[model samples]
Target: MAEAAALSRPAGVVGRRTWANGLFVLPFFLTFLALMVLPLGVGMWLSFQDYDMLGGYGGSVGFENFTRLWEDKIFLRSVLNTVYFVCLSTPAFVALGLFLAISLNDTYRRSAVLRSIFFGSSVLSVTIVTLIWRLVYMPERGLLAVSAGAVGLSSPSFMTTESLAMPGIAIVTVWWIIGLPMMLFLAALQQIPREVYEAAALDNASRWTTLTRITLPSIRRTIVLVAVIEVILQFQIFGQVHLITNGGPNNATRPIVMFIYEAGFRDWSLGYAAAASQVLFVLMLAASFFQIWIGRSKQED
Candidate 1:
């Protein structure tokens, strides 16, 4: 009888402990299920339905949304614009950030000030960044124009010209985002062993040779990590495009996110916008997987 009682006591204790642990994690798990999993599931369902007040949810149309999107000229244009922006902004930001990080990593004095200046870009809200750059890119009333006039040159309308608008947006994006990678790269640079450089110099390696052979190889992992992050972030660019261009100048600067917003909110086509969002999600997932594969391939080599 005593043996059975002892076993029961332990079993009850174990059950209680398990419940206690579950109680601690239950809130977070429930929150994730509600906020992320549930929304994603509903969004996926809505993507296929064609939900609109006029057209209404015409039920599951079997990939009609996907097909319709492919046939959409504006959608296609937006995708291309997004691709261009990502291609331009990601590389520029990553390269410039790495260069700045490498330069500042060795500086002893004023390093804090330089670091702050670079990092300060990331702290600015999207509205502030967009407003600031809008003024700079303005035709006659802007800094660029004023500078051109000072130099006895005619001012060009950067934002109004389709040729210059996308690039101008990209420049602002690069300036704002370079800060993140710069700080990350700076951290990575600090972790590199100083002895490695000294040894390279002892072997009579020139600065250029040392940089190419030593510094670069040592920082390859950091570069790859930052590059992947930059690519992902650039692909989803919305704020700058919306605030500055509103995807204007003949849809030249329209990105996928802005397109989705316009479709859902502006046009009141929630289902179509949801479809566009799913496409964007898939594209981003594929790009992320590709980056991971490249990183792994580099490691194997």
Candidate 2:
């Protein structure tokens, strides 16, 4: 009886621990289901329905909404513009973040003040960021204009120029988001064993070799993570453009998210907006998987 009690005690403890773990996770699971899963499911359903602001669900439209997207010149342009922004912004996000992380990861340079300065902008609201940058981009009187005047150059209105508008927004976004990747890389850099660098130094490994071989390889997964996150984020860019250019100067700066917002709220075409949203979801999903595959392939190589 004593042996049986001892055996049963372990099983009872395991059961209680399992229940405790489930209880701990229950809140997050419920929140996710309520917030993420339900919205996504509803969006998918709405994509198939002929929904609107006034009439609500006006019955199913089948694939007409999705199929019509191909014929949408504005939608196609928005998609292209979004891709352009992603291409413009992602490299800077990854490279600049890595550069800043590597530069500041050292013992002597790991200054809290400096990190905070770089990271400070990211915590600001998008509206604030746009407002601040609006002053910087304001023609003939703003910081850039003043500086350009000082240099005997003219600073044209960036927000009005089709060629420069998206780039201007991209620059602002980079300033806002670069800090996160830097922090992520910094954390990953710290995780690398000190002994590895010490051995590299002892073996007469040059700085370039140390970075290319040891530093990057050690943080490859973090690199992929930062890249993927930036790609997904930049692809969905809307707030900056909405506040800055309002997708003006020939729709050169409009993005897919902005299109969805306008289509749903502005035009009251909720079904069409939901279809566009799903397309975006699929694009983001595909891009993430492709990046993960590429990262894994390189890691394997």
Candidate 3:
């Protein structure tokens, strides 16, 4: 009976400890469920309902909202615009960011001032970045015009022109956000062992050879990470496009987010807006899964 009692005591104590641990985690779990999970669920619910009015949710319309997305011409154009911007911006962000990080990362020759000059624009608010670029992109009085005049070249207004507008926004976005990817790549560069470079130097490796064989291979994951992050970020571009072009000249720069905004707020098509948001959510999810697949594949290889 004593042995059975001893065993029972430990079981009781273990159960109490487990309960205490759960109690400690309960607040966090509840907060996450309330804040993140609840909103997501509500948004998903809202997407299916004809909830046009601000606080008035109507009956479920099933997949009507999703079906309309394919039929909506503006939404289709916005999706294409978003894809164009992503293609233009993602490579520039990844490549230029890596270049900046590598160039400024030399321990012997690195200058703080140079680093700050390159990275400073990134921390500025979106409005400030747009305003600054607006000045640079100004028709005749801007820096680009002034410089081009000095070089005997024509500087057209990129913001107003249909063909140039999206590309121009892409350039500004790269300047504004390149620092994030640069810093990320810089951190990854720092993690590469100094011994790797030293060994390459001992082997009489050229700069290009060392970079190709040693530097890039070592930070392959980081390059992939930066590319995926840039793709995700550029996909949701709204602020720069809105401020600079207002998706204008022909709605050429209108991104999916801007379309969703105009639908939800401007047109009062809440369900349609929510459906567009869901599509965006799905695209980002797909990109995330791709990143995971790449990581797993690299590990296996």
Provide the global lDDT of candidate 3 against the true structure: 0.88
Ranking by TM-score: 2, 3, 1
lDDT of 1 by residue, 40-124 (tens): 9998998988788566667777688889899999999999998888788877877898889888986677877898888988999
State TM-scores per candidate: 0.89, 0.92, 0.90
Q: What lDDT is obtained when candidate 2 is compared to the true structure?
A: 0.92
Best by lDDT: 2
Using lDDT, rank the candidates from best to worst: 2, 3, 1
Q: What lDDT tens digits, residue by residue, belong to model 2 across residues 1-301? A: 9888767787879788889989989999999999999999999999998988987768999999999998999999999898899889998999999999988887664576778889998899999999999999998888999999998998977888999998898899999878899999999999999999999999999999999999999999999999899988888899999999999889999999999999999999999999999999998899889989999999899
Q: How does each model score on lDDT? A: 0.86, 0.92, 0.88
Better of 2 and 3 by TM-score: 2
Residue pairs whose backbone atoms clash in candidate 3: none
Q: For model 3, where is the 10-residue window of minimal lDDT? A: 106-115
**What TM-score does candidate 2 reach?**
0.92
* Candidate 2 Cα misplacement greater than 4 A, ranges: 1-21
